[model samples]
Target: MALDDSMDRDPIHGSDDNSPDRQGRSTFVAGERTGEIGVTLSGLRPPSRSIVEISPANIARRRLANWGAIQGERVNVTRRETFEYGFQAPRHLLIAHERGEREDGETLIEGLPRSTLREFNCKLSFVPAGHKFFGWQTPRVLTRVTYFYIDLQDRLFDLESGGARPTIGPRLFFFDQAVWDTALKLKAEVGNSDPGSRQYAEALGVVLVHELIRLERATTATARLIRGGLPVWQQKRVIEFIEEHLTEDISLAALAELAGLSLYHFARAFTQSFGVPPHHYHMARRIGRARNLLQAPTLSVTQIGVQVGFRETSSFTRAFRRFTGLTPTEYRRHRGG
Candidate 1:
């Protein structure tokens, strides 16, 4: 059968053969030639130009395809800190051949320095299917690409209704494992015989976001060092400082000054009082806030770090692991929906 014929019977991209509408095709279009049907083709040349739409669904698809095409899993912001947005592209179907691959893999997609600690905003442009970003080939079957402009002009983009900021800002982000899993599930749902499967996925996404918000709160307190004393007054003051400058690094030194205590005196006193070091306390606060922002499936990890005062993803990871006993991915998996 010819490529176009096969496509007519079943689009190479969108519709799955096993779907309820098996006799028809979906939105996917691989390479359909005139009158071709399920014809096998390799080394196919992509069109000279490919345009991707910047819609939410399409953006989600594009990001997922880029990170999970070979891996089969979604991408997650793992260790966003000072240098770049650290992405955790989990091992999956396409690139399961390697170990520690997820730990070592990182792609600095885009950014510019805003100052010593912050970077400028970014406008994510959708690349055509099969195009390359870094070294990965974008999924070839996508119908549209979503465009997200990360406004880094202000690193602190809050979770409007949440207690803390969770995601990194100034860039588009994808979780290798999460994106892949979500997309695959979405695809599977679209192919499911049940009429409500797609609806379920949509519901699941909403639940996931809510769960993320709750988890962010639980984890944030770990980064802080709270103790006895002027409980109400101190809490108010600390909370005010933390909330006001979630993006700027919060240190024991700074906190002590705010509390009107010497570094040594504050360290010993605060530890005795809060049961943790000042630095640990501050970091806990930041991470907790970060966890909340991360709940937004849309924001990137590096953006989260920038929002939470992490100078780099590596530093964030180191600190996060020390406090939480798990990598960000592990935390997200256990905590995020």
Candidate 2:
């Protein structure tokens, strides 16, 4: 399940004002806003339009990962707003609402409702590949959401059966903690300076896809869990690899390839062997490294945090506290003093 290197070479086709897509009647202007790379969707064709377009004013941040792109936005409507929009790309779309709610609003796709009444945070809506949607919403204070656009054509989850690939049905106002958490992680990488963020984003996309597939199966029957752990040699190799790239954003797909296992099987086997998830193991190792670095009085706490893969001092502090029940400052004051 190693990621295809070709994804890195694929040209990202985004709309521009000067050169608009012939099929679509809209133009986009790409630029960086407040350190976030984004595209402003504008120039709707029809004369009568009140569509809720995906614009920079609505989008807070955006990140283009390998298999898909993630966008974080806040939709604010002072007055009642109704709109109809459609996406042309043949890809799956996931929208997670973090905040806000509207009891009167209704969003429809292909003549179906997308928004739910009395549901606010963590609500999700999914649009399958190649589907066109039309939505309408009532006036609300503001709604914060994260959008995950997945290009299913990339064949990131190829199965050996050679049968039809699993497809996610359009769902509205559902709750999936796993998908929500992964989307948040992807959103966090929007303007990350870490060199491994891309790998991390790609890994999250793979996990999200697998989770969606599992969700699809849950409707009919329980998902069968894969048995057993990795071989001793494979376990050792993956452990060594993690240690070597402790500072980098290690992808689960890459690790699965090293073990010659599917992502699902590899994750199960990894947890079985190590008594923790791969991400937790990596974080533990990072904190261990941070502990070792704390002893060196010359390195500041922030420097130690960055060295151990935490981009923010607050995040490093929180992780350090969670792992050792002490912040970096407190740990250094007691242990490294």
Candidate 3:
């Protein structure tokens, strides 16, 4: 059959006949194509230029791509203290925070309001085409993330479906076990040279898309995080104040007034919004920022503590030990070690 005719059938399931989608197609077993349905054409040119939207500072990227369109990157934010991560691509991006913990950071996705909730280990973030995803973090440990780039097109963009697109919404810091597992499997084949690995990754990419189609904002816990939290403008203002005054003491009444809520209500709402009480969150931010400062060899432990709002070095050491199970000196040395 002609290539265009074959393209009309389900790419994964195949046409009525058991023949390959194209005439004389390579038996490399490639992944799903960004476009041009049916079995993917070998040496097929990418639909568009692949764009990676990570900052170049202190970032190391390992990229993987097959003869088709699915591209993957394992981004390692080196132990240089802190790093920023964001996405701005012509294609969709599936982000898996494989293993990373942040002491301090701001997460902003186009769909969700800005967020100050840190701890993103195993979190999943999906940024649809044309949306912006931005975040910068002061790390508590080495940060590693796998970014799976889904070629944005109309599989209508599934591998098994007709040319009609499925509804897939944007999500930030959400959880979806199916998408996460499929994305990780695809990422594992990034550098593999085995003959079947490419095809397997491609197949996994198709599976990942079907998983993404299952993302429903109302059905997920992500909506609850906001539903139980503060308003968007209030969350932004409150987080900004906390970030600006991390090295100083800020009162709850002050924050409450800022949020235009009474003291009692503000405390409850802030905790509900950020999953932590106001004071506890403030202190954590101070210590988190201090951890970042410790990475600078030029700064003395006492200076770092003072910079993060400690009146004395001893008090700073005790608080740091309380929060992180290590004194300032020990934490710094351990990080170096």
Candidate 4:
């Protein structure tokens, strides 16, 4: 298959005026060929391009959104259609099947086969850079899928092996709740016009890439910590301080001081004992407090966000979604608030 020369150009910020259906949807001609389906993955390359055209029968609607070089799309498959196509790129590909009725299809990437995907079953596929992958599927029912494009050269993973890049093999139908959750958040950010949406999308992209690295390195032996963990009194003091100052700008330096250790050593020892970074633990505590505040009908979302240390509602929403996979309002609603 021939590559689209236009794809080499900067991504076009599509508008509803340019859409064939004029349904207020943005559209762009991602490539010249028709075989390539779905939206172009973002962040696979700097100044990424968007895949605007998709088979009308195969895709009912698609929304393309970008965060820096990372791009994503939410696709609604309308009909059952078989397609055979290949993708060649310098970036990695992540695909998550969000929704589907009949779980009776097959996909093959570089001759590796996987059975049909089921909803929320932790099934995802990863395609590495410099690879040509072929996929064929004929869904028996309508489906919703999301795709994330990532550039390996971004140095986001920090793999740094004497300038030798680590390579990830093709993964098919794997179970990873974290990756799935991050993809869902990315999908939720698609087509959002808020000013902070891009930053939220970028943060989610970083998280997704980190999860990818963790998944790839799962089999490797972890480095041993210099010491077991923070002393018992230090751990208790830190936890209490975090709870009391949940709304303050608690810095890593301050936490390290409280723990009476260097920044690097404190971080390592904290993770060794708590199974999460200090910042992560702090965020979890904040989110936990926010959840309780959200249950109170008297407090508005903004007020709750402020009470939980977030200055902006958007940032709070993004962080909350990252932890619980739901916005504050969504969580409250589900909890019968």
Index of the highest-lDDT prediction: 3
Q: Model 1 TM-score?
A: 0.30
| Cα shift from native, residue 161, model 1 (Å) | 64
TM-score of each: 0.30, 0.44, 0.48, 0.45
Model 2 compared with the native: what TM-score?
Answer: 0.44
Best by TM-score: 3
The pairs that clash in candidate 4 are 42-70, 42-71, 43-69, 43-70
Ranking by lDDT: 3, 4, 2, 1
Give the per-residue Cα lDDT of candidate 4 at 220: 35
List all candidate RMSDs to the true structure: 25.2, 19.0, 22.1, 20.3
Residue runs of model 2 more than 4 Å from their true location after superposition: 1-52, 55-88, 111-118, 159-161, 222-337
Can you write out model 4's per-residue Cα lDDT over 156-223, one digit (the tens) per residue? Answer: 54546577666677876666889988988888899989889988888888888878878777623222
Give the candidates in order of TM-score, highest first. 3, 4, 2, 1
How much lDDT does each candidate structure score? Answer: 0.37, 0.60, 0.67, 0.65
lDDT of 3 by residue, 110-154 (tens): 776655555678989887876666655567777788888777473
Candidate 2 clash pair list = none
Off by over 4 Å in 3: 1-50, 152-163, 217-337
Give the Cα error of residue 76 in candidate 4, in Å: 0.7
Tens-digit per-residue lDDT, 48-114, candidate 1: 3222111122233223322111212232222221111111111101111111122111222224211
**Positional deviation of residue 52's Cα in model 1 after best superposition, in angstroms:** 84
Clashes of 2: 0
